[model samples]
Target: MEYLLFRLYGPMASWGDPAVGSDRPTALRPSRSALLGLVAAALGIRREEQSLHDKLAASVTFAVKQYSAGVLLRDFHTAQVPSQDKKTIRRTRKDELQTGRLNTVLSIRDYRCEGLWVIAIELTEDAGWDIRQLKEALLKPKFTLYLGRKSCPLAAPLSPKIVTSDCLRSALDTEFEPILKDSDADRVWLPKSDRVTYYWQGRKEATNLTGVSSDKVWDDPVHRQRWQFSSRTEHSASKHREE
Candidate 1:
């Protein structure tokens, strides 16, 4: 099997989870929707192009090797919101703040500090684009890409590569040079644990993976504009590196 591999490192990353009320939580690893959005942005696919987005979402699966989930960071934000009206659609934050009778809304946003992850992209039989095309897109993305939020910029290059491996696990195991030299390893924030975690979605037989656990997650993108997601099963495993 062929896979497109890439590295993502940033000072602040937020892999959003199912959010409710005033609290917005984040996952340890990147979500499926976030990965799809990253690739779509690289390809210059617009959010209004629902058909293309759906096609791309169905065309690929991902396996993430989480080297560092990073430490938890929270931000307290206060925004002005108009009266509750399901009929009202505010296009921008400015528009919302300008609306009649503004009310203060408090929100707590979560982020991971100096997170690092390696993503492996596996194509489906109905893939719209080949692995090489995806690699090229990442190399020269049409639109600027950020780790998660626009406020959180990438600290390093994606360093995308293509690897042909027998199984999904092997593809994820593919390595690249460290983002920083050995002397500068401690210059930035990184996890101290040698244990690596893997998260993927697919049949065990097809992926040739022995997952320690599996659970349903609601990160699968259904409609980007509407911010709708569907549930899918994700399998996970862990490995401790030997010195």
Candidate 2:
């Protein structure tokens, strides 16, 4: 099987998880919806293009090799908004501010600092776009790409490459240039573990790694406009590395 491979390295990344109230949490790895959104942005697909988004979603699956989950960082934000009134119509921020009566809203956001992950994208049977086309789009994305949020801009190049492998694990094991220099790693506290983790979706046979566990995550995109997502089973495995 052929896969499109790339590296995502940034100072901060926010892989969104299920949100509750004003507190937003992040997952350890990038969600499927976030990966698809990255591809759609690279291909210049807009949010309003529902048909196109649906086709793309059905056309590909994802795998991830997590190098560093990064350190957890939390932020607090407070913003002022106009008081809610059903009778009043505020077209923009300017109009809302003009109301004079304002309310303060508080939100807590979470992030992963200095996170790194290698992503593997596999084309499905109904794939409309080939690996080469996707590679080129990623090389020169039509729209700017960010890790997960607009504030978390990428600190390194994606370094996309196409490789053929017998299984998903082999594709993910393909190496690229290191994100950080030896000196940088020594000076800064880069997140690392004795065991490396792998996550993938699709049939077990597709990913040859064994002794895996499964869990349901609600990251599957159903509709971008409506912000709807469906749950899907994800498989994971971990291996210990020699110190």
The candidate that wins on TM-score is 2
TM-score, candidate 1, is 0.91
TM-score of each: 0.91, 0.93
- The residue-by-residue lDDT of candidate 1 on 92-148, one tens digit each, is 888787777798889999999988899999999999998899999999999889877
* lDDT on C-alpha atoms for all candidate structures: 0.87, 0.90
Best-fitting candidate, scored by lDDT: 2
Where is the poorest 10-residue window by lDDT in model 2?
Answer: 187-196
What's the distance in Å from true for residue 41, model 1?
0.4
Each candidate: RMSD: 2.2, 1.8
Q: Which residue pairs collide in model 2, if any? A: none
Error of 1 at 162 (Å): 0.8
For residue 78, what is the lDDT in candidate 1?
97
